[model samples]
Target: MAKITYIQTDGTSTIVDVKDGDSVMRGAKLNGVPGIVAECGGGASCGTCHVYVDKDNTRPLSTMHAVEDELLYCTASPRLDNSRLSCQIPVSDDVDGLVVHVPEKQI
Candidate 1:
């Protein structure tokens, strides 16, 4: 399991043990972590699961796919260099201790 931290807009933090191969969005939903809406259920369709990966994190995430790249533009929050769809991030030892910041809104 990978330990992923989700930081909310109000400065709240939630740490969850996400099973390997599960998307970060799935982890948040399973653990009842606030902020991740996941309206598309990890289908990479809706951008409700958008998150900002910690810029200082050393772990490298998977390359963004074309679909995810396009969807990021539709997120409620302003897209940043670190913006990513939580559904596109799979949990594993490679990304253990990953920290993501949740935007203020997801609608």
Candidate 2:
């Protein structure tokens, strides 16, 4: 299991143990982390599961696919260099200490 931290807009932090191969969105949804809406259920179709990857993380995430890249443009929060769809980020040992900040809105 990989330990992932989700920081809410209000500065609340939730740490969850996400199973390997599960998307980061899956970990939030399963643990009731109050940020990801996941309207498309990790299909990478909706941008509700958007997150900002902490710049301090040392590991590099997988390359974004075309669909996920396009969808990032539609997220409620302004997109940033670190913006990413949680559904597209799979949890693994490489990202054991991953920290993501949840935006204020997901609509």
Best by lDDT: 1
Worst 10 residues of 1 by lDDT: 33-42
Assess candidate 1 and give its TM-score to the true structure.
0.97
Q: In candidate 2, which residue pairs clash? A: none
lDDT of 1 by residue, 1-106 (tens): 9999999988999999999999999999999998899997889999999999998989979999999999999899989999999999999999999999999999
Candidate 2 per-residue lDDT, tens place, 17-83, comes to 9999999999999999997999989899889999999988788688899999998898898899999
Assess candidate 2 and give its TM-score to the true structure: 0.97
Clash totals in order: 0, 0
Candidate 1 at 75: error in angstroms?
Answer: 0.6
TM-score against truth, every candidate: 0.97, 0.97
